[model samples]
Each structure stands twice: as C-alpha cells, then as structure tokens.
Target: MNQELLKLDQVSKTFRNDKGHAIQAVKEVSFRVMRGHSIGIVGESGCGKSTLARLITGLTPLDAGEILLEGNRICGLSGKAQRQVYRQIQMVFQDPYSAISPRMPVGTFLTEGLVHFGMISRKEAGKEAERLLQMVDLEPQLSQRLPHQLSGGQLQRVVIARAISIHPKLVILDEATSALDVSVQEQILELLVRLQKEYALTYLFIGHDLAVVRSITEEILVMKNGAIVEKLPAKTLVRDAREDYTKQLLSAVFSVREFQEP
Candidate 1:
C-alpha cells in the first residue's frame, strides 16, 4: 500500500454569529489520502465542501482538529513553514476569469511564485514558464497574453499549469472544471488524468456533480449539511450509495442526462 501523503484527524471548523451562535461548517471530518490517488468530495452548495478546501489550503484558521502532511502537523505553522507547506499543496479554484489577475501577463502569473520562492531566477523563469505551458498543451506564445485574452478553457489550463509548476504533492481542485463548457470540461479532465499519471499527484477534488467526480476520482465522499455521510469507491457510488442524499444527487444527475438526450 502507498504511504498516506495527507491526513485529516477529526478536522472541524465553525463560524460564530455576532450574537455568539456557533454555526459548524465542518464537523469532525477524518480521512487519509495516499500518494498517487484521488479523493472526491461531492455535495450541494453550502454543504461545507469549499470550506473544507479552504481549511486544507490554510486560507482559514482551523477551529479544531489536525491537518497533517506526510505525518507532520500543518496547522499553526510559521510563515516560513507555511511557505514550505504551500510548495507541497496547491489549489486550483473554480473560476479562471477571477482566479488570476487580468492585468498580469500569463508568464508573470506562472513564474512569479517560482521566483518568489527562490526556486528559479527571474531570468530563468521565462523558459520554465514556457515549459509548463507546453506541459499543459498550450502554445508558448499564449504566455505573453493577459488572462482576459484567453478563453475560459485556455485560462483554466494556465491555472492548472501554474498549480503544477511547483511540483506539489497534493493538488486540491475545487470545481476546477465547473466553469467550462461540457466539451472543454472533458478535455480538462483528460489533461488532469495525464498530468496525475506523469507526476504521481494526489488530488482532493471537490465538486457537486457525481458524474464528474466519478469520472476522475478513485474514492468518493458524500457530504450533507456539513458532514460526510457516505464514502465509497467511485465505481460503486451510483449503484451502492447507502445514503439517501447520495442517491438523490445521483438521480438528479442521471435525470438531467435523460432529459437532454436527443
């Protein structure tokens, strides 16, 4: 068996109202992600899927529990340690249009982080940026254009390229393909599969669509009302979900497909 690359032990998060009413966003979520495998988290909006992503990425402080990377606690790290953590864990958000700056050229967007971390010099970044763009199947010239100049699918590939440029051990893709057209979504998914095989990447893919999640992930986690209600192999999710919520979601997805078929 592969050694666990990441672990969440009873991880929890809460947000309190001004009146002191605590609303739990994530409740004691626990899981392990092994190297070179993908775990999918699926839920409707407001089910704490995005909050879990935020907690994993250190965008927010954890109110409770532990997050570990390679058996080391990642919570409460100093700035220097956090920067090191970032090199191991990266995220690609849902919207390419807003995820990157409109004013920054694609080359700058891809290379700035590498240069900031002293991994590569500014002079060497251009060639490295072009290399990454090629890895994502984009022409090197596209790096000269701004974010707004590319179509949504093209910008998303750039985002994926930047996320992988640092060679992260784990990549959290929170609805990374949700913004593109259906055909574009398939292309991006294929690209992700290729990249993962080439890089041995462990993915934490968060999305609402069961079909999309099932297509790329090995394990599927079903969340409802801020808690995981079911966990199953991706191949069995539609046929063997023990939770009504999971069944309902699967039904809805299939219903739409049937309704749209010619």
Candidate 2:
C-alpha cells in the first residue's frame, strides 16, 4: 500500500466568541489521506468541515495538533518553507466567483501561479494557460473572457483549472460544486474524477451534500460538533452507517429516494 500523503493528528481549532467564550471549531480530529485517494468529510452545516479545510490549507492557525503533508510536518513552516507548502497544496474555495480574482482574465488567472512558482516562463505560462482551460473542459478561447461574463458553472471550471495549474499534490475542494445546477454538478464531478485518475491527485473534499460527496470519495469521514463520529467506506457509509448522526445524515440524503415509486 502507498504511504499516507496527508495526516491530521488530534487537530483542533478554537475561536473566541463575542461573549468571550471559546468555540472549539474542530476538536481533536485525526485522519489520514493516502496518495491518489479522495477522502470526503461530510456533516451538517455547522459541523466544522469547512473549518477543517481552512486548517489543512493553512488559512487558519490550529489551536492544537499537527498536520503532515507527504510525511513532512508543515503545520508551522514559514517563509520559503511555507511557500513550498503553498505550492504543493492548493484550494478551490466554495464560491468560484469570489475565489477567482475579478480583475484578471482567465488566462492571467491560470498563469499567475506558474509565474509565482517560476515553474514556467511568462511566455510559456501564457501558452499553457490555454491548455489549462481546455483541460477543465472549457474552450481555450475563453482565456480572453472576464469573470462576470462566465456563468456560475463556468466560473467553477475555471477555478478547478487554476487550482491544478500548479500540478499540486493535494487539492482541497471546499464545497466546490454546491453552487452549480444539477447538470453542471455532474460535469464537475466527472471532471474531478477524470483529473484524479490522470494526475493521481489526492483530495480532501469537504461538504454537506452526502450524494455529492459519495459521488467522488472512496472513503467518507462523518463529522458532528467538530469531531468525527464515524469513518467508513463510501458505499458502506451510505448503506450501513452505524452512528445515530451518520444515520441522520444518510436519512437526509436517501430521502430523495423516498419520493420515488418503485
């Protein structure tokens, strides 16, 4: 078996409330992500799934525990080290429009990371920008377009392309498809599955949509109140969840099936 690509050991994050109370966003959470595998973290709205992504991507400082990437401790790196971590792991945020810069064209948006990492020349970045667009199932000609011109689904495709432009080892999708319509959501999931196979990408996909999560994840981690209550294979979690919370989540997801006459 392959070694783990990412590890979160007893990770915890706390926020101070306005009332001067400490809100533990993630409490002693631990998990491992092997290379080329997709791990879905799913729970209800306030279950801290997104907060966990923020912690993994270094957007928020952890109150406790360690996060290891490729078996290297990266939770406290700074300067050049931090930049290196930033390069190897990228994030596609929940809102594509908000995640992408409004000021830059699609080509510029994709190439900027290449330029920042010195992975390619400015001219090369410009050329590869078009390819990146195509890779995401978007027309290369769309490179000239601005964010406002693209539909919500199109914006998300751009976001996915930009995230993979650097060819990062890990990509965190924080509810990336939640903003799209049903057809577009299917397209995005197909795109993600294709890319994962092609690039051997390891993803930590965080979301509330169990169906959406099930579509992509090989394993599922079910969370509640900042702690993981159950960890099971994706199909097992769907059909045979053991926890009350997991059953509740599965109930909500399979509720769609309840409406159909069989």
Candidate 3:
C-alpha cells in the first residue's frame, strides 16, 4: 500500500438558505486516500459529495477541520504557495460543455495552466497541447476547434487532457461520466483507469451510481444527507454493506441490468 496522499480530519461545512436557516452540507467527514489508489464517494444528489470535492480542491472554504496534502496543511495557504499546492490536484466536472468556455480554442485552453505554471512558453503551448490531445486519445487537429465543435465524449476527453496537462498527482472527478451515453461512459472510465496506471495518479471519484463507482475504485465511501454512512472495499460493497442507505444503494444497482445504455 502506498503512503497517505491526502487526509481530511473532521471536515464540516454548512450552508444557509434564503431565510438564513442553517443546513449542514458536510458533517464531520474524515478519511485518508493512499497514493496511487482511486477512492469513490457515492451518494444521491445534494449529499455534499460535490461539496467535499470542492473543499479538497480549494474551490470553496471549509467551515471546519483540516485538509492535508502529503501531510502538509492545504486549507489556508495563499498566493504562489497556494497555487503550487493546488497545481498538484485537478478537477473534471460532469458537463464538459459548461466546464469549459465555448469561445476559447482548445489549444489555448489546454495550455493555460502550463503557461501559468511557467512550465512552457506561449510559443511551445500549441505543440504541447497537441501532445496532450494525443495522450488522451484525441486527434491533434481537434485542439484547433472550439468546445462546441466536439461531441460530449470527445469534449470530456479534452477536459481530461487539460486536467492532466499539468501532470497533477490527484484528480477529482465529479460525475465525470454521468452525462454521456453508457458506451461513452465506459470508454471514459477505461481511459481514466489507463491514465491512473500510467501516471500513478490518485482519483477522488464522486458519483451517485453504485455500479459506476464500483467499476473503477478499490475502496468506496458511502454518503447520505451530507455524512458518510460507511466505508468498505469495493469487492465487498454489495455483500458487506451494513447501513440501510448502503443496502438501498446496492439494491438499486442490482435491480437494474447495470449495463444498459443511458
């Protein structure tokens, strides 16, 4: 087993409605992700799975506790230090269409981070973007096109390429395959698995589908109502689930064909 890559200790978050009533989005969540292993966070919508991803990636502020990367505190670092820490993690959102700007050329989009990180010059961005596109199984010429020109699956691949262009150690995939056709979903998931092995990248895969989560992750965390209900190895998820929510989720997965196209 690899050493701990990330640790979240008693993390919590609260949200306020229009009337200013408090709603706990995440409640005392705690976990550790070992290096080079993919961990799945499965739950129904509004369960704070997405919020947890946001917290890990520093997109949103944590209301409590600490988020550590490689045992270093990551919650409050600022400026270059903050950016440097964040550069180690990348995010792939569910909707590629909305995730990227429709107006920017793919080449510019892919190399923006590389340029910002001083890893490459603007003059070399095009070539590097082409290389990244090919790495993600996309055609180099596609980099010249806009986001709207590509299919959902193609765009998702582009998003993956962008996320990895910076060579991140961790990738947070928030429902990354849920919006595509089932076949496309499988292809994307397989691409993720291959990328993971090739780069030794750690993944924080968030989704509502039990079967989908089980397909790629070795360990699973079940969440409901903003709290983690159980944690189990993926192989034993169906057989060893103890919580009613976990059983209900597993039953739902088994009730379906589990492979039908969406």
Angstrom error of the Cα, residue 61, model 3: value is 0.6
* Model 2 collision count: 0
- Candidate no. 3 TM-score: 0.95
Error of 2 at 33 (Å): 0.6
**lDDT-based ranking, best first?**
3, 1, 2
Report every candidate's CA lDDT. Answer: 0.91, 0.88, 0.92
lDDT: worst 10-residue window of model 1: 250-259
Q: lDDT per residue, candidate 3, 92-133, as tens digits?
A: 999999988889998899899999999999999999999999
The total number of steric clashes, by the backbone 3 Å criterion, in model 3 comes to: 0
TM-score of each candidate structure, all chains considered together: 0.96, 0.96, 0.95
C-alpha lDDT of candidate 3 relative to the true structure: 0.92
- What lDDT score goes with residue 147 in model 2? 91
Question: Residue 117, candidate 3: how far off, in angstroms?
Answer: 0.6
lDDT of 2 by residue, 91-149 (tens): 98778889777878988988888899998998787679889988988888889999998
Model 1 Cα displacement at 6 (Å)? Answer: 0.7
